[model samples]
Target chain A: MSYFSDIYKGIKTLLTGMSVTGKYFLTSRKGAITQQYPDNRATLKMFDRFRGEVIMPHNENNEHRCTGCQKCEIICPNGTIEIIWDRGIDEETGKKKKKIDQFVYHLSMCTMCALCIDVCPTDAIIWGQNFENSVYDRTKLTRVLNEPESKLMPGVED
Target chain B: MALREKNNKPNSLKTNNLELGTQNMKPETINSNFKSEEYQINMGPQHPATHGVLNLLLTIDGETIKKVEPDLGYIHRSIEKMCERDSYQQIVHLTDRMDYLSSNINNEAVCLAVENALELEIPERVKVIRTIIGELTRISSHCLWWGVMGMDVGALSTFFYGFRDREMLNDIFEETCGARLTMNYNVPGGLMLDIHPNFVKRVKKFVTHFKTKIPEYDRLLTENVIFQKRTKGVGVLSKEDAISFGVSGPVARASGYSCDVRKYHPYSALDKVTFNESLKTEGDTFARYQVRIQELWESLSIVEQLIDNIPEGEYRVKTNAVIKLPKGEFFQKVETARGEFCVYIISTGTKSPYRLKFRSPGFSNLSVLNHIAVGGKIGDLVAILATLDLVIPDIDR
Candidate 1:
């Protein structure tokens, strides 16, 4: 009698397990959780706060907000950001000011920790929403964030 | 020749003659001819059952495992050594790699240690938010463990169901922290940013969705006959042995050791929330599984209590650009999804710590494997390992 009872209990539990899977199987079409990533590229959107890569934004005048403070470079744990700057005369004030020659950003070495973004005093650098950062060449990952011939925005230093 | 001699004797005296002959026989002859030999096998540096790059050397006699020696350092990233060069703010990100499933909790532990050394008082809003996020991290980590536990016992469907629930939590994390896996949200003074505007709304939605799915989980794996049979009495650890081995989290709770760091220490807003420790006296594999499942419910309740009541205030307190701790030692411990995770820092009044040490939970839990797994079969060893829910990087770190 105990042997028969054990078999009955085993079957009953297995059928209960089967019912859970069976319900999912019948409704899987509407309840599917998987996303077709590449195919849905047009409709796909990342969160506004996603930390994909660091980028320097420029207005239509090709002017930026960077005042060459180098705070981000100094605070970066991995030396991912490098700024090359030289003294130049400010056209408006006729005073020599430190301006960036190139804001070198190594995307390859970036951990996406956003430490630099947090430490940036000028708000020159920001998180981009683009997450598709893969490339065939490693050197391509080392990017110059500022556009060519870009200069500091007017009154940004003030 | 010994068998032939026994056959010639009378049936009543045969047993006596055989015993006498064997007692007189040389020990080396018996060892060379009839003794069973123990063999060794490797479970993995790449084995999926290990859940990460953990190499286990197992000694077995026939089907029973004689020993399980965990060979670590395969994925050792030298995170403690790296902490020596990084600033207090920079160190929080590196802890994320240690236990990636509970990265937010790992980040919070380092931040709390730094804050304690600074003697800074955190805002009420920060405390409540950190507690809510930590509990969510616990639930997500347990979700992954549940899936892997079922898969380890040959139930494949649990993996998909577990990941489906975890994906929702990841989305909530990404929207708020900006990264899904390694969320460097906690800083020394407070959080990196305020919780996203939709954070409360989305979390409320997740709590409702997850409440219904937990019952489905019980049916899918918990009540399954095969899962129960594989886990019930596979590995048993007594309360005394659990304390002696220094095991914590669900592993120690299953043994009725009362070692929940959250209950005893009550860091962050845990003192405000009332929840059970989820204990079981059985200490077997099934008990461990049940404890983690019960914890999932407790975590959900914790989120519900704190979600609508998040006080509005400044998210972070301003700290020095170059943070140099006064010359002293500081220690802080937080209950990660695994167990008690401690951060010890010895600062010589510099921007970086002179020495840093992490007391991870997985390493201590892994030490008890050989003690419990000796007499169990190889399959039972896998089941025991699964219920332990070891994150290999957490151990190696």
Candidate 2:
């Protein structure tokens, strides 16, 4: 009697388990959790605070806020930021001051830790929400943030 | 390892003779028998059951495993060594890669360690938010483990069911901290930022939804006869063995060891909440499975209790841009989903740590595998390994 009861219990329990999966199987089409990633690219939206990449904000006059203070460069643990500055005369004051030549950013080495962004004094750099950072070439990752012929914004003095 | 092989050879020979003598087996039948010699096989730095790049050298007689030797160090990034070069705030993110399933908890452990050393008081909001997020991370980690456990034991549907619930938590994490897996939300003083405006509402919705979904998990896998047969009375670890092996979390609790870190050493709003420490006296694979399933309920209760009462205040405390810890040794332990994760730091009054060490739970938990898995069948071994939930990067680091 016990042997028969054991077999009966086993089958019952196994069926209970299968029923759960069967319910999902029937409703899978309506309850699918997966996103078709590349196909849904047009509708994909990142969070506003997403830390994708670093970018320097350029204004209408092609003037940026970077004073080349090298705080971001110093705070970066991986040496991802390099500020190439040369001394030049200030346009408004006509005094000898440091002007940014190039702000070389190594995207390949960046860990996206946001340490540099947190320590920035002039708010020169901010996180860009563009997460598609894949590149075919390594050299393409080492980007110069400031565009050519761009200068410091007036009233931005260190 | 050599002595065990010598001992098994005689046992196999005795079985071989018994096979031949019974029913007077023919010579050709004896020669063709697959159970000849005890063979040694390596199951990945790449195999699926290992869960990560964990190479397990299994010595077996036919399908029965005689020994399991875990070969580690494949994913070792020398994170502790790297922490010596990184600042106190920077070390928080390094913990994200260790037991990545509970990265929030790992980050919190380091932050708490530094905060305690500094003796800085954090606001109530930070404590409550940290506790809620920490429990959420635990539930998410266990959800992944439950799915992987079913898949390892030949059930595939549990993976989909588990991930279905996990995606909700991932969405909440994305809204609050931007990154889904390694949020890096915890800093030395408080969180990286305040909780999202919709955080409480989303969490309440998830809690209600998940409460109903858990029973379905029980029906799908817990009560299944196949799952019970695969897990029950398999990989039995005695209470004494659990302690001696230094196993914590679900593995130790299943053995009736009374080793819940949250209950014993409450940290950050854990004392304010009321929840049972799920425990089972039976130390088999099924008991381990039961412990985690029960904990999911407890985690839900914890989140529900705190979601409505998040105090409003400064989410972050003002600290120096460059934090320099006073020269001394500091240690802090927190309960991760797997077990108790600990961080030990020695600072030389510098911006970076002088020496840093992580007492990851997976390391001690993985050490017990060879002891329990010696005499189990290959199928049972998979069941045992799944219940152990060995995350290779955690062990390696």
Candidate 3:
């Protein structure tokens, strides 16, 4: 008698389990949580704080805020950022000043910890929202952040 | 046959056989020729049930497992060794890879250790936010575990349901911390930045949504007769054995052992909020499963209590760009989703620690597997392993 009752209880619980999934099946179209990726490419938007990749934003005059300060390079945990600087004569002061030659960013080695962005004194580097970083070649991942011929923004040193 | 004759057990069997009119038969015939040999099989390094790259060399005699020997180091990144080379702030990010599920809690552990060593006074706001986020991390980890545990036991639908809720939590983490899994939000002094504008609103929404869905979780899996039968009596770990094995987290708590790091050594506003240590005395797979389930609710309550009343203040206290710890040993332990995750740092008044060690919960929990899995079947081993809820990188690191 107890054995028969056990089977009954088992079936009842199994049905209860099925009912949870069954409700979802009935509301499948309205309740679907999966986003149609690539199809919804235009609609897909990352959050404002999303740390996709590091990019140095240049203004209309092809001028960036970086003052050749190596704070980012020093603060970066993975050595992801490398800044090459040279002493150049300032146009106004006529005195030697540190100017950036290159700002090399290795996207492959970056963990996206955002320490570089946090430590950037001039807000030169910010997180870019473009997350599609896949490249066939490994060397393609090593990118130069500043645009070619882009000079440092005037008065950023202050 | 000659070897059997040399044994005293065979002599007794031969005398008994002679009385039974089988004296004409050889003495060796007294014993049955049927023999069973214990064979070895590797469960993983690639197997789905092992969760990560954990290899278990299972010795079995037919259907029953004789021994389970876990082979680790496959996914080892030598995170402890890496910590020595990294600065104190940089070390937080490496811990994210150790227990990816509880990345926030792992980061908090290291930060707390550094802060303690420096003797920095953490503001009330930072403590509250850290506690809220840490509890949310716990819930999200448990949600994933619940789904995976169900899938391991042949319930496929739970996976989708679990991920659906987990996606919301991941979005919240991404909004505030900029990364979903490896959220290195906790700096040594405080948080990296202020919470996002939508952080409180979104977390409140998730709390209400999760409150309703937890009941569905019970109906779908917990109360299911098949699940109960598979787990109830399987892989029973007694209270004494749980302590002896040094298993912390739900695995130890299931055995009626009171070892909640949060309850005992409250850190980061944990003392401000009240929560019961979810415990069960059965010490079986079902008990471990139930303890984690109860904890999910406890974590929700904790978040609800603190989410609305997050005191407004500066998110981060400005620390020196180059932080050097005073020469001494510092330790901080936080209860992660798995168990007590401890960070021990020995600093020689340098930017980086001289030696750093992580006492991860998964390592101790895994050692108890061979003790419990001996009499169970191969399928039972999978169920037992699933209940352990091991994140292999934590063990390997």
Q: Whose DockQ is greatest here?
A: 3
What pairs collide in candidate 2? none
Cα distance off (Å), candidate 1, residue B365:
0.7
Predicted candidate 1 versus true structure: per-residue lDDT over B273-297, tens digit per residue: 8999999999999999999999999
DockQ of 1: 0.64
Predictions' DockQ, in order: 0.64, 0.64, 0.70
On a 0 to 1 DockQ scale, where is model 3?
Answer: 0.70
Off by over 4 Å in 3: B1-34
Order the candidate numbers by TM-score, best to worst. Answer: 3, 1, 2
Q: Model 1's lDDT to the true fold? A: 0.92
Chain A alone, model 1, TM-score? 0.93
Off by over 4 Å in 2: A1-7, A156-158, B1-35
TM-score of chain B, candidate 1?
A: 0.91
- Error (Å) of candidate 2 at residue B64 is 1.2
lDDT of 3 by residue, A1-158 (tens): 97998899899999999998999999999857798998999999999999999999999999999998899898788899999899999999999999999999999999999999988889999999999998899999999999999998998962
Residues B19-124, candidate 3: write the lDDT tens digits: 5564455666646445777889988899999899999998999989998999999988889998889898899989999999999999999999999998999999
- State the weakest 10-residue window (summed lDDT) of model 2 chain B: B1-10
Q: Which has the greatest lDDT? A: 3
lDDT of 1 at A147: 92
Could you report the Cα RMSD, in angstroms, for every candidate shown?
7.5, 7.4, 7.0
